[model samples]
Target: MKISPKKTSLRGLRIFCVAAKYRNYTLAAEELSVTASAVSHQVKTLEDELGLELLTRERRGLRLTEQGARLFRELEPAIANIDGIIAEVQSKTAASQLRVSVQPFFASECFVPVLEDFTARNPGIEIFVDTSDETAERHPVSADASIRLFRQKPTQLESDALFPLRLIAACSPDFLKRYRKGQEFTPLPILVHTSRPEAWNIWSKATGITLPPATSVVRLDSMIAVARAAERGVGAALVPVPLSDNWFKYGALVPMFDEIAELPETFYLAYPKAKAEIAEVKSLRKWVLDLFQE
Candidate 1:
């Protein structure tokens, strides 16, 4: 079976190689963000083309069959060549303009609306994003700049404070009037992200308002999920000020109380120590800082 490049994806090859080397489909799946079955399918596809048994399955996990070890050793150079090509492409792209990584929800809610505005102002630079739930430790070091929400001096990166963070209690206003109409704001489901487990407690402490033991407390992994649940009247969510403004403006959710807590937290514009000197990166950093100035 001749494996044509068009017939198979590079992803299948990479996943197969990683699984064979590690002898763990689960580990390969974790790295690739897929199910174990998906990894198995890719590896099977590779094995079918090569006419070989890649692994012998065990109750614990995979153990390499004789053919698998030989295949793995031979494939290492192919993998390294692919990696070099990828790095070359990325480096060329990186040199041309700005590469920014931002927290996903914040990018959608806060940064996106004004994104074209930044582009308009800085016509010389192009922007790319590596958006995710949160910044990985090496994230700032990897990109020209990062838009992040947390309060810490990232090692080696220069940070310009964007805004002091504001977290507010919010829910669908009509939900309040309809579901819990006559009752005091006591019993209501509360949606909190895992990042801020004590949000309600902190807000209550700051405002000196004792909310009744919550009717429901659901933990979510993302602010977007928390905000969406609150929009659907599934629960109340503590949302950052930057996000709340857009949601309320669009009639998605309403601030439950006017009292906002200034989280000892802030979002910052951070860039790698080396990349900060690049013209495109510097322009974007200034553009972001000017938003706060206005």
Candidate 2:
């Protein structure tokens, strides 16, 4: 029987390929976001149009008939190639626009300084940086990628470790001088990042320096605020190294102790695993890994 081009449904053929590959209508339906009945109907329509039986349903699940297997063998590659071409086209279109979510601290201290370099290199890509702590922490679906601190590697997302977060106890020069006591800063108030309230405790334990009893804790929402508070002598704060390098260099803050508290958390550049190979994602991943990884 000759198949009529007008009568044949491309969707039906694609459904048949999926049904054949999985050998189960339900499975195919799940992948295609359709009902099993819909999958069955599409396959049946394809079989009628081709005048061939593509599948034989059995008690165990599903089985492909000889003709169905042959059709699948031929059509799968074609469908995959077509899918690839479509993805390529879409990727190129998306390559012009990129959205990245970043932690506020990283945005101000690290990313912004070097953003011009990336823009200069990829002039065609218009990148939007969202520096909201909420978006950076949750890694919302809208963002193409996120740069955030993670204690454990994110298993669900494709990620590259950028750098370990080493926090140092820091205070304003005046605070350090006032509190300095034979290599130990006297128990002054501890400026704490609200997200990591235990940061000072961790630093104290790591360095074997006991936090004084009745030490006041002033909680702030972000690392930048903590750094700024410490710089202004509000309290001695635990500040992430490298990100706070400029603060130390410019004499805004000085290290209270030589020891560093290397937290379990590390900064990571992360994106959906499925987007790993997309042109824009790939470019951003490479650029970020190269720029930040140590």
Candidate 3:
């Protein structure tokens, strides 16, 4: 017989199952923390819904009828499996650890300052922030999510854009004054991040301004290093906005030109599609997007 879920009470079904397992309403009620009368009522309700005599009383005590035995055999394992699944889900949601791969520059400049608040709000989440320079280009194998610069949204991963990347040619106030010549800073050495050797040319082309005539190029591996070199008046550097805001604010660096070169690359929070709905991943996605979204 087909059983209608609407007509059957899960509580009744559970009570019946427990009573059948121990062959005693008193024993089942003790385990369920209910009165024996409550257990008998539940079993009677379930038997009525099923239209079958599920239990028989005899001199030897309670015994399952043929129909009851059949139901118990099928329902016991399914109920046990359901319990196991519930336990697994609760375990996953209760204590979670997240591994995030973040660009080293962004981590130091933006993320670290606000990280404490995130930890405080999600005390159950243990987050490992991997800020190694290598995470700048790709998501780390061990990371549940990553923040990096991408020209476009990754097709294979779920992504959220934080902000566009803008580069400005900047130099120390002293360097600008020394290099100024006839309203032009040309002839000054171009400080460049080694990863983007053609950065100056790209900026120059975007702004329609000619660069210095092949002067000595100072190349550094990281953007922070390039910005620091520019701060020391070594040369003019193509520095990113927001990240370089403090440097420009305190006069450690000043824009050499009024033009800001916008790049297709943008800061993005990305994670695997398979882990998109994971609790830890979702928490990070929401926190990061809320914190950094422009």
The number of the candidate with the highest TM-score is 2
List clashing residue pairs in candidate 1.
none
Residue runs of model 1 more than 4 Å from their true location after superposition: 1-95, 136-138, 179-183
Q: For each candidate, what TM-score against the reference?
A: 0.65, 0.68, 0.66
Q: What is the lDDT of residue 190 in candidate 3?
A: 78
Which sections of candidate 2 miss by over 4 Å?
1-90, 134-137
lDDT of each: 0.74, 0.80, 0.81
**Using alpha carbons, what is the TM-score of model 1?**
0.65
Point out the higher-scoring one by lDDT: 1 or 2: 2
Give the TM-score ranking, best first.
2, 3, 1
lDDT of 3 by residue, 217-245 (tens): 88888877887899998988888888788
lDDT of 1 by residue, 49-153 (tens): 777788888988898888888767787667756655655566567556677888878788867778999888887777887776364323433466787765665
Q: After superposition, how far is residue 137 of candidate 2 from its true place, in Å?
A: 5.6
Indicate the worst ten consecutive residues by lDDT in candidate 1.
133-142
